[model samples]
Target: MTLDIGTQHRDASVSGPSSDLSPSPPSSPGLVSTHAAAVSPAPARKPTTASNAASTSAILSWSDEKVKSCSSLRARKDLRRNLEVDVLQNIQKALRTSPNPFFNDPGAAAQEALRQAQIYKAWIQDQEGSSLEVAIVNDHPQGPADGCPPYDFVWVNGYVHDDTIPPSDPSELQGCDCEDDACNPATCKCFQKAVRFDTLNIYKESKQFAYNADGTLQDMMVPTYPIFECNSKCGCSSACTNRVVQKGRRVEIEFFKHQHYGWGVRARHRIKRHTFIGIYSGELVSDAEADRRAIVYEDVGSTYHFTIDPHPIKLETMRKRLASSPEGRTMTEEQLMQRVNDWTRLMDLYQAHREHKVTAKQLKEFNDRQIVEAKRKGEWSRRWQAELEAELAEWEARYREEPDNYLSLEPEDQARAEDLSLFYEDQQEANELTVDGALHGNFTRFFNHSCDPNLATWPVWIEEGSIWRPFFCFFALRNIEAGDELNFSYTSAEEVDDMVKRLNQIQVEQGTKPGTKRMKCLCGASNCRGFVFG
Candidate 1:
């Protein structure tokens, strides 16, 4: 599904509901289908001789005015940066308490929201006085009755409710008898019900879990497990081994608008694997309600209805059955770690070269050798090579112009330069578990879709009497640096054939040009499939 929020309006339009948005089909297994809307082309108008001459004159005048305007804007933006930094620092300082004080009290939450709004108002100058208020609230903006409903933010526990059906009674809590700090799979009743993990609490049937532990799942296509954490009913401490997701967010995150993909979420600090990011909270509606809203959203090209279909137990059983086959086994954990280390070293070297700490000859030789190796492995792309070369050239020019100033950099400045690029570059759609935030959701709703997502979603179940719903929790799939946008795949397949087919059908029905019906993907991944919807 494509979420195209037009720059002209605060309201977002959806292309269609995601396949997962509806009831899961029996045949597709992990694959969920999503809808895409028809895009109509604007009619072209004939320009008269007088209009053409006048247009040319206007273009020239606008060009001159734009340059001066941009320069002045840049200066003003720089002046505001110090104040912005101070505000952010103060906010961070205030939020240094454990368990996030904002979640504990309404006053604290409002204060935080107000501070965030100030920062957002300054950053998004063009959006001042707009209805889309930038605040750290726990609830999404309420929509109309026929539209999506508002929902409160769920911290650790999951909430399940369908508007079409009568709400089910909350599930009763059944506590385990284990008295250990952390529950042992050998004796814990809750752990005994688990089919995927062994007595040691380690995944029993696959090497994928091991690879994830070593931070090597970045490039590999692996299926994620439906993680069931120790809930409040468990006789374990908060620091229990199986209590990762329930611990709440450990890293700071921000929601901001992107130049291409409307609004997006970003990390404010470096994040590690298995760390709790946030919960995908929103109104829980039935498949019928989701479909109805989806059709309404499609009229305006809005697509943000995510389905909650956990990875079926049968799928994991199938993977285990295939594990004995040659094709089923992935790289060894040691080999994966080695590859990650090699990439990190290469990036460090590149940074050194850019800083002029390494000679030009050294940089060129390393680049040439890597290019050859990458080509031999069929891992190189012309687009990436050109981008790298251009960046290097730009850096060289900047260094020559300001040698001393550029070399004397702050710690954050150095870190920013080294961590600008994303960690992964591949796409997978089948394993994605999602929640729809099209009409109403918190900051997490702004996270854009990426082929090479650095974040992964995990299911968290907290015992709340008779309520047993899975909170779709996100975590850093690998180490992610500050300033990097958080992303995840919206589709389950790497191919764009389905997306293209939908676009073509829409174009034919709308009587528009074939190629002009689809939205271009702004995700700069090398393996991007052209359009974001696929």
Candidate 2:
């Protein structure tokens, strides 16, 4: 059962003292900068009203009275071992007594308090010295469903899985060898791959990074590429300019109720363009399990499964694939040299293209260079070209008239698409994953939908070793004011419009209308569409 932690928070809504029923241990040591709300006795007061509940950082403060710092060997571990169990028992009792529906049972609210105490404390401790706080609040008028949580889940900051362990330590083994305290874009080993290729086998003349000096994404538009940050594999210190998403969220966030929208998120302070908020996280399940849950969630009137599509990551995987190419297969000096020559010509072609077309001089130079290189290699290059032509012909036959389609595809996508979805059983090649955020997630789970959004999600490769498992980090698409709700489009209205047209045409031909799931959109934006997930 999901518990709304905010509902329990309403009990401690009075502005001054914390007055928590049970005071948890003080903030963990070594994390001196990040303080847990200290608590003290408080006079009986009113529950949180809409005015004070605007931002619950003030309402939920444990105390202004500071406890002694825990710098010594005598750090307190005063919390009861059976706290979660005891809370669960109490919740069971609350459920049995309550006449309201099970979803809004008082027990649900109580369990949420314990879950928050456990989860938030652990999440804060996971990242040393992190001052980030995702405060939970509710402004919904008290009623049978007043204790309703935004969504039911055992909130977690990291992915929850039984068998899928986290990526191996990147910093210890394969990390960058640079000794400089901060990484330099000119030579940092991590940026080398990103700077060299615009896509797999495509080259660029210069390095361009989207991350600004202050750790903000400079661009908020549709991304042409995913940001590869200085990860656990980087030798640079914490201040590296390229280190943004891995540093974790930097600002204050709140999960609060909206009058119309069930639950929504907002920042307490002004957010500049492209600020890194946090990643979309949850239970990491297989594609098949995700499908099972999809049916279950829909029947239950909610959906939390965010599919992890590997299409966007196909290009990013080239760095590793290219490194170890020809390891198994044999190649002569002439063959390797020919391969290099072909790559050089490809780089030229890519660099020469502007608005998807190349200039005549550059095209002539590219063709001349390729012809010269092929002649230089003689029979070895001739054999290589014949083999490539054979391979291309075989691939083209599968697509029929769509012979050049692979040109627009990432190498990995093309490879899988060759075999078709039915044959994609190789675990590494076919990453069919879905994050069940309904049951496990951070504050990011509550972000509502909008037709015109202020936030946009960009794939970011942090320490997650698999490019397929890159984090979906949300960046501020525009400068956002304090107290404004944060949102992103679930799916574009344009896509919806196109789908509707296609579906209508199909139904007209069949003389039957098949039912489709449609969740009406209440975003109320200037460009608001009537519905979402239509």
Candidate 3:
């Protein structure tokens, strides 16, 4: 995916990265850096197929990059194991009609796959470091050429302090339940530092999977959002005043949003505008950990880096058809069947097919097969293709039905939901933002990015599920039309001068102030902010 680097939409919410030589002030309690909150995870969900030995090796090498740097080592192992199981499952399913099942032997396939995985890991460690992270694995045969594998790897730098040292070898580090004090390495003062690599490298070894040219992992592109940490007690309402707590951390800083801008809670249902979403709940995993626990969703026949929502579309097509039918209640079975057939046929016609031609040899083989055999093969292929196409169409339709509401169901949605919900609940309870963990305000998701915006961010405290939390609350600068794309200033309204400075810097970057990209602003508002916020 192409990043809109030149536009304000990309940098609006989060502050730009601080210079390496100077660190920003320590974030106030109840607030954290936006840069720490939003992360574009590695892409391990997508896979590809290979036909020859070289292609298979390329696919394995490609997938290795994506699986290596997952948060936890355990997760990465599990993911690789799961991938092997998926291959075994497909092999077994394929063997159902074979005279012998040697090729379908799970144990044999697993052994071979595992050996390959170990070798791949060794190769990566030799080129990169001892620890690596995998972000994406491309396994399709029709992907890009130029020796790119189907996966990308993110390498993590491990730091060890002089005063205290972790295990001489990470492999010897005993696993402890995070819930226990033993898991708190902080107690031991053991200096173990791990840092993620910034550069993305694809193996490009095979066309089947998404991989870089050098057997490294490519970044799973993520939509960036400006995140704000509440620095002091705040609320969407102006009447609310800042106050330091009598005890505990003083609540400060609020992220920005839109719903609370004008009507506040009156503008929405179920959740109030700027209300808390949910807290992060998944296991903390790096590339290695994620790969280790990577359990392939058994039903899907592949490894899914993120949680899979098994909820089927359960399409309402039948109901829609029934509603449109005339004299529907009194229709005969044949009539109903005819309607169903017509709809099915129409759907089939609309489905996209690979224009690539089939081989004459394959076609001839099909003709030579027994009638029953040929029919079974044809039915299997047709049904398989149809189901895949149908699911894709349903997903697309869902996105169209309500882009904001439905897009949240994508893989990244679960993580964002937890972050937003946690921010709100924490505020209501403790009257502060979460300071110890990452916080995310996915406003760009629903609000849409704008060079100009009509809302400002405010921090609020809320309680949820018996915990106090902080949230970045959005307030309106003006009464907005119902359908106008909701936008909030990425910079704080309280700090207008700084905002102008930031905007000026962006203009300079884009050559608008001095350089020369010279793209016209698309924000139609009369008072569109001239530049995107970082």
Candidate 4:
């Protein structure tokens, strides 16, 4: 049976032979169909009459609808499969081209290096002499030591020495039996021995964690802690949480020269609180050696000797008495208020001295009266007072010998052992556990002093083969933005105030510029003390 599926509007006037059983016109326009005979079984006899054509046309139309429906469904299935394949291919391409999110991006690091180079007008070297990348830019064309030392980052199990010679048979502290990845303070023997104390050695306590939960300075004003990490003798793995400072620096840092200061170090990226920065690596000298170095470095107008003492000592009897006293454990509201008032008054006096509202002599007299009051009220022990007096006497003798040098010294350096006998009275006060980086040291030596600083130094002791030695490590005190210069208060707040006052008084008396006697502070902090010494 024939089927007419073609359009009927083509060349209507053209003459053509008409068959008796011409295929019936398609029911709708533009509907093309296969022959009904091709799709179904052929008829038993061929009918050549027009009456049979209508029946054949109806059968053909039904067959044509079925064929079209099948083709449409097949096309849809093919389209869906194509789309899925395209989507999967795109995913694979992205996986190949994208960077690993877990690792630092190389392009980012390169950009940072380029930026530093442009700012410092020097080449920015990568992790050439250190495990962590440190960019050094030395633009100082005049100094005897214009460039950094050619030493790769060295991880010393103990104190850093001047020469490369290692210590012979160093003693290591005994480690604990901790099975977990990190040691539990409750069970870890090393942690059990860690010591903590307030800044003034007033209130002391042991801490399980080195830092607070959020990594900020602990609220207790306990400035220093004896850091004891899981060592080789411990059962814990290297992934232990206590294994922070030992892991070395994990952030970008740059050592660039400053106009006023010879060289200064700055953070190349935002540093988080409590993150390990770098060790103040230098010659591990004896107390006598450090003193000698300090005297020699004084000529150059700077000293890199940083004491390693975790904290000042407290008498056993005093500590026991304080611990047993109920008042020591907690303060009453009245007592707290008095302490705050006392501190506020002291700071106000310091600010007045800075503004030249008070003379250095007058300030000293007031401070001396305060000390007397503290002693009278039993805030300071008789023994401590006597020790301080004796130290003052000794410093006075030294100042008498080099009065001229004392005048020429920087205010902070002068505070080291100069005319401010009342302020720097303790011989040990100037001679605590200092990590001297004057001769041979790392980039941390370049970190300048700030009254309000962004970095804080911690004393880290690593157990060697037979001994525990100190490592001075610095950490970000707060969230430091990238390209920010790093600094730490070289002296305590009280000492800084005294230094500023002393410098101000000296400048007024000598009729000289603010920075004539010492290096002028260009720190630009709102509370900048006008001198870098403080």
Against the true structure, what is each candidate's TM-score?
A: 0.44, 0.60, 0.21, 0.48
Among all windows of 10 consecutive residues in model 4, the one with the lowest summed lDDT is: 1-10
Each model's Cα RMSD:
23.1, 16.6, 30.8, 35.0
Pick the winner on lDDT between candidates 3 and 4: 4
Best by lDDT: 2
Q: Candidate 4, which segments miss by more than 4 Å at Cα?
A: 1-131, 137-158, 162-172, 195-207, 211-222, 312-434, 464-468, 499-517
lDDT of 1 at 324: 45
Off by over 4 Å in 2: 1-137, 144-151, 164-173, 200-206, 310-312, 316-430, 504-514
For 1-534, candidate 2 gives per-residue lDDT tens digits of 010110011111101122223334235423222211221111232122111112212222111011101101001224221233235334433433454444354445444433443443443333223445545555442332232232233334555453333333444333566677777667776666454333432223334455778878764234435566776667788877778876667888755656655567787789998788877766665545544444333233344555554333433333333345665146543344444444434433332221133233433354322432222111111222223223222222322332243356567654444443223224332464556565446667677777788877776666655655656678888898988888876665565565465546646866866344444567778887665532
Rank by lDDT, highest first.
2, 4, 1, 3
- Root mean square deviation (Cα) for candidate 2: 16.6
How well is each residue in 1-534 modelled by candidate 3, as lDDT tens digits? 000110011211111121111112222311211111111212222233111000111233223333332323212333332244234333322322233334234344333233333333333333222232211111221111101122222111111011111112323222212333222223211111100001121111211111122211123311111111112122222211111111111111122222111111112212222222221111222222222322221111222121111101001223234546576567754455455444433332222111112233434344212221122111111222223223223333323232233232445644444443344333322221111010011111123224455544332222211111122334344444433444543223333344354445655655655221122233455665443321
Q: lDDT of model 4 at residue 490?
A: 52
Q: How many clashing residue pairs, candidate 2?
A: 2
Model 1 TM-score on a 0 to 1 scale: 0.44
Error of 2 at 299 (Å): 3.3
Residue 60, candidate 1: C-alpha displacement in angstroms? 36
Clashes of each: 19, 2, 118, 13
| lDDT measured at residue 157 in model 2 versus the true structure, 0 to 100 | 52
Winning candidate number (TM-score): 2
Compared with the true structure, all predictions reach lDDT values of: 0.39, 0.46, 0.25, 0.41
Per-residue lDDT over 1-534 for candidate 4, one digit per residue giving the tens place of the 0 to 100 score? 000000011201011111121122222311211111111111121111111001111122111223223222211224332233233324323322344342134343333323323322211121112334455554432211122311211112224442222343534356779998777767876664443223333223534456443333344423344465667788988766667666555688776655454456778778876666776654454444444433333333344455444331222112333445586458653344344343333433343232332233543454433433222111111222223323333233323232232345456644433222233224333322334444334456556666577877666555532222446677777789888888766545674465455445545765764431233556666776665331
